[model samples]
Target: MPKSVLLLWLEGHLQSWGYDSKFGVRETLPFPTKSGVIGLICCALGEKDPQDDFLKELASSTMEVKAYKNKFNDKTEQGLSLIMRDFQTIGTNYDESDPFKNLMIPKKSDGTKPVGSGAVLTYRYAIQNGKFAVFLEYEKDLAQAVYKALQKPRWDLYLGRKSYIPTEFIAQGIFNSKEEASQKLRQLAEIKKLTEDFSVVEGKNCDDCDVLLLNDVPVSFGRRKSYANRYVSIIKKED
Candidate 1:
């Protein structure tokens, strides 16, 4: 089948690509996850459904990410801090009688109220000053739909979380091949005075890279979200 590649320039002051951690302590991965990217695409298409069929079509698609940082020098590798922690509190002082406020209160799986003040503390981590170029290979027809949706997204497009607004345009363009998208990525990095820091490529374990298994492939997307595992290779740029 014919394929197309999309070049997405993801640059933002704050972004969180969640991989692990729970409600009390949310952590972020160093790079974007397939699930997160798919979420962005769904948002652009204004698709709030489970979208099992749509996601299945690109189940075997190729995705590559190029991480960038502020250029310091050829000998020195310079980048902002990997993680930024933000402390917050949820479900505080809500009346159980008020239906709207009652929904905010923490509840047990059985729908009963929690055993405490119903307030919980959370530690959210995000990437600071993150910049990445993502190359997503898709079927020609699906790629065109995604391209058009991104140009005028139905909903606001964010890097990861809603608050993490992108500094640069996410839709660079669609190309005929991954190589074409990569060349565009290099040009964008050069124009922005950014240097390559690392990369995440979809694949199994290899001798020259760090292999990671992530349960981030989306299977369903509504209230009861489900995911599958995928292997990716992370290769840091050699100094």
Candidate 2:
């Protein structure tokens, strides 16, 4: 049977998937880690700490990603081409005396363990060329359900942090073929509702070339020494 897949274009001014970050000088993991992606799924499902079975199911699923290069002109320079830097994350200062800090602290299951000691930290980043893409494989029924849910997303989608809202809808419907996926994305672009600028292209490893092209918008979070997040959306050019 042909596997069902959901092609998501996750772009924001700043996107951070810090699986194991330290208190000061937080670091972003390469690619979305199991814990981070699953956490987001749990939020979308409107549940926290979901059942073990649910977590296992999601963790066991196959997820793949690829980075791309993005080139654009810097507004500061007169038509000077600028290479946008990949998104990254910075750690926030925490008060050790605060009780809540301990609970929210990045720790391992043994509880009281530091991240670098044994904890796993994973983050996802794509090249800046507005060409990065992620491919997710799921059970057919589940994929369809997810696609439907995206049509009318109920939750507020953000880059990595909630404060950084998406310029366009991140979640899109499932498609039968790569052609179909590209068509849907084109339709979205033609409508002129995207939050940032972007383009769509074929997937490199995709057999059918089923994938969405995304151009991320640069955004910063917090004050002083803020990190950048890239926001992206599905779009197409008008004929």
Alpha carbon lDDT of each predicted model: 0.87, 0.45
Q: TM-score for model 2?
A: 0.49
List TM-scores for all candidates, in order: 0.91, 0.49
Those runs of model 1 whose alpha carbons end farther than 4 Å from true positions after fitting are 73-77, 93-95, 107-118
lDDT of 1 by residue, 1-239 (tens): 69899998888999999998797999999888899998998899999878899877755577888898887565444554478999999988888799999898988889888887877789999999999888888889999999999889999999789999999999999999877887888888888888888888888746878999999999998999999998899988876
> Which ten residues in a row are the worst by lDDT in model 2?
74-83
Worst 10 residues of 1 by lDDT: 72-81
